[model samples]
Target: MNVETITKTLNSLDQLQRNTAIQSDLFSIEQTSDLTVAAALVKTLENLGVRYAFGLFGGGITPFIASLEQSSIEVLQFRHEAGAAFAAIESYFASGHPVVVFSTTGPGITNALTGLFAARWEGAKVIFVSPCTSATQRGRWAFQETSQYTMSNTGIFTSGTLFHYATTVECNSELSEIARRLALGVGKLGGFVAHISIPRTIQTSLLTTPLPHVNFSPTLVTAGEDTISKCLQLLCEAPFAIWVGFGAKDAALEIRQLAERTGAAVMSSARGKGIFPEDHPQFVGVTGFGGQNSVLKYMQEQRPLRVLVLGTKLGEFTSFWNPVMVPSRGFVHVDIDPEVPGAAYPYAETFSVQSDIGAFVRAILKYFPEISRSSSVLPLPRPEREVIKSHLEGLVRPEFLMDAIQRVIVENSDAIIMTEAGNSFAWGTNILRFAAPGRYRVSTGFGSMGHAGTGILGAALARNRKAVAILGDGAMLMNNEITTAVKHKIPAVWIVLNDARYNMCDQGMNMEGFHNVDAEIPSPDFVMIARGMGADGIRVSRECDLEAALEKALALTIPFVVDVIIDPTRPAPIGSRINSLIFHGK
Candidate 1:
């Protein structure tokens, strides 16, 4: 089995045969002799539908990086390991496909932990590939040694909370088992994060055994007929409200239909924006952190009998476990993971159902009559929109900037919008309105500062269209991949709120009666940084220039940046955050 012969054979196959060979039971053919462990692993990942690989190339992980370059998977060399991991997570969300994040050992491995943890928390399918020290160099302090002697092998190299499945490839014999485990893990419902670490020597070792043949079929959990009937009965018994989360994104259509049929007031978690059209008549405002005051008003006034929770864990960021959100009849919560339903609101009576959000919703839709009529005529609360006129001289207001973005970006284009953690998240969640799913992405679960600033490149690349990232200056300065984006000519637009401070912390401190918090930073000219990195950029100091700057950034074919100098004095809508902090005695 020579390399040239294998290439010729693959090239000679018909399109149908090639598709079948690559997608179904890829390892059944005799193809191990010509491939090394790294090459075999790359092929396996490609067969598993991994289209992109992002990471920094180091000596330890050179073999895998080289293999990735040779394969059909698009490879990107990021500026930082954490940025690469964040990009990998966004790539999955954008393409609805699993992505690979590669790294070297020791420091590279450690730097990528934050993004990997976020990938798990965000419920994404991401495979982490890295290299470790060889068995012979256990005690000796090799440069950046990653072995039992230097690093803790418990969570990094072994299966635990960090990864759904993890292992170190010690020999060629373990390749089949590893491939099998990965196939199963990725095929299952919900997020799957797996890590494979190979020693530098073992990476290039010729495979002795063939990779396992896996006929992988995705496992979709769906509710039974009885369960659907029970849920329907609960809904019809009394007035109910619909609460949408990020996990129910795929089921947006069904959720919308359900809401319309029941005439139920709908509210979404911060990350769950756009699942149901925010402008719909039955729509309420977003709930939880950076949420609207309208939601609280609706809860106090309308008081639905039971709330139907979809796909969210009702965590602190979404629910704050606020007693006001709890209804009289309790919750009929649905999620793929059974543990999630009761864990968020343990005291509340919850009827838990373990099922895929879309499948369950589709099943419920099937039971409905063909000519479905509205169930109620109660007037619902709608999210408030304020019209603010710009001032003559001072720095730009965030509200004015958001208004421009909403009109220019959200209303005009189909580009995905992402927001970084901090005041940026609060502003975007509170102001920007979306009417469709797959257009908004946020990481409330992990809430990493630089996640969006660095991840927008991957999102834009994967979506094959423009993607906008709204981030604070702290995040822009902390971590960004503008250089990598310029090199690849990715159509990513970064809108940085250049207020020269960690405004969220600053504002929160003021509200909490803290003085002189020192959360300020001397901000840099982000436009100059973009220009230096070979990307185009614009700076907006007045509210009048925001729409034009946004339009200019969106029109650019290459990577672009829009830096907005905002007024830090105007407090963001973070009163709920301060209340939550005070409630917890922080």
Candidate 2:
């Protein structure tokens, strides 16, 4: 058949298949006499599997909050709107379910900008709901007014920079379309943030018609036969490695199978840690700032002929965009987003295939049996595990802290480990060995401080697992949601590495041969702060007291904080990137 006829036939078949599936999945609308817009909104969200809504309550959003109180969805109140938004994002990360975040008006929505930005950057699925000035009193300077029609430079939320879909619902008729958009946004692959602003007047409006249920069944994108053939041809040539990213989290089993079948050495981006078992013989270390040197050495010395880039953008933090990390031969890139293939490294020869990571891996697995006997590729040599048990001296060192945490994790294998940006992330990513996916959570793309401090609460609640948030003293002081955790009775352990300064910044300046005094900052006793917040607290300054304190913290039913005074003089483990940061500018 001709290309045009073939394409037409395939399109018709796809539409027919979708129609058949939709017929089965469609929900019958049950008409209710007294369904307000607020109730309809909450019911739609509940139908979409949203169980929790995090935010502060205010007069502007009183109706919506009241409706939520009547619904099955649980409302989690936070001191700050940003904390609530961050918590929702983290919850989505843990559960793979989009959560709702609310804000009042004007400043409430603006305060949530940072968290929303981080959510967008990390590709987290979050629905942001906020109240706007009443449609009747929009331009006449209403109380806490936040209407795009009246405010100046207020387009940030709706500017498409932070949200996949942003809309202000002024009428009851818009709710159905809004519900459909939200369902579609959440159903799509990768993270998406949707913002819906409901005017105060519309919240109490009675919905005349029954709310329509959206039929959401995302079709899996798989590699075509031609793409598979090309990939197979590339794999037939040995000495190729696989690079995995956070997008490949669901394809862990298939990834492992592919690596073993081809005898390919596997490395991962920082966010991709624990996707493939790091302890496996075929596993090379992570690629990034806090990455393993042995992996870099392997890439430098035993240069791979080609690389199969799986679901990673290979951005500045991942590859540093340096030639040293980029394979000399070329790369075959696979990603869910069609635009992400050659975005980072356009200079290199990139064979791009847009497909879901799991489906793509499974597709590649089918061809593995055919070429299994013919492929004679060998895995890279295993890197030596650096023993740092004896490195514990007078003051608590970063390495010693990592070792202790590793020991604690080994004992409590089910606990989810999280880290804030800076030294905490570097130490955790480098030292902590996660055997499975969903155990290690870190926000490296946005790299926002105080993210884990608040985000851990949502993660703990979502996973129903003990969450250990290892963060810097600065981050802990910035926005610790310990109060929220305590209020909700979440089992969260906060390990504060208190160096009495922004150690990452201080060390970076020192490495660059520049002396900056602004890096040093006074830190309050976190133990006392935790106790003040109605949570248990412990102070551990010595190395010997570390593991015991961790054990005690882990056993606590409520939120607990372990404040460890780390040595400020000791440098953070920021491998080769120091020179790159210093000399690249010169």
The prediction achieving the highest TM-score against the true structure is: 1
lDDT against the true structure, per candidate, is 0.87, 0.82
Given candidate 1, what's the lDDT at residue 458? Answer: 85
**Per-candidate alpha-carbon RMSD to the true structure:** 9.5, 4.2
lDDT per residue (tens digit) for residues 482-552 in model 2? 88998999998899999999999888888877785588778789989999999989998888888899989
- Superposed on all Cα atoms, model 2 deviates from the true structure by an RMSD in Å of 4.2
What is the TM-score of each predicted model, taking all chains together? Answer: 0.94, 0.93
CA deviation > 4 Å runs, candidate 1? 1-27, 369-376
Error of 2 at 321 (Å): 0.7
User: What lDDT would candidate 1 get against the real structure?
Assistant: 0.87
lDDT for 502 in candidate 1 is 93
Residue range with the least summed lDDT across 10 consecutive positions in model 2: 15-24
Give the alpha carbon lDDT tens digit for every residue of 1-586 in model 1.
2334433443454421110111334356565787899998998898789999999889999988888999999999999989999999999998888999998989999999999999999998999999999999877999999999999978998888999999988898888888888888877778999999999899999999876667685647776655665777777677689999998999999999988776788999998999999888878999988788888888999999999999899998898888899998899999988789989778998999888888888777654443344466557778899987767789999888888899999999989999999988889999999999889889999999889988898899998999999999999998999999999989999999999999999999889999898998997999999999999899999887778889888888989999999999888988887888899775
How many steric clashes does model 2 contain?
1
Clashing pairs in 1: none
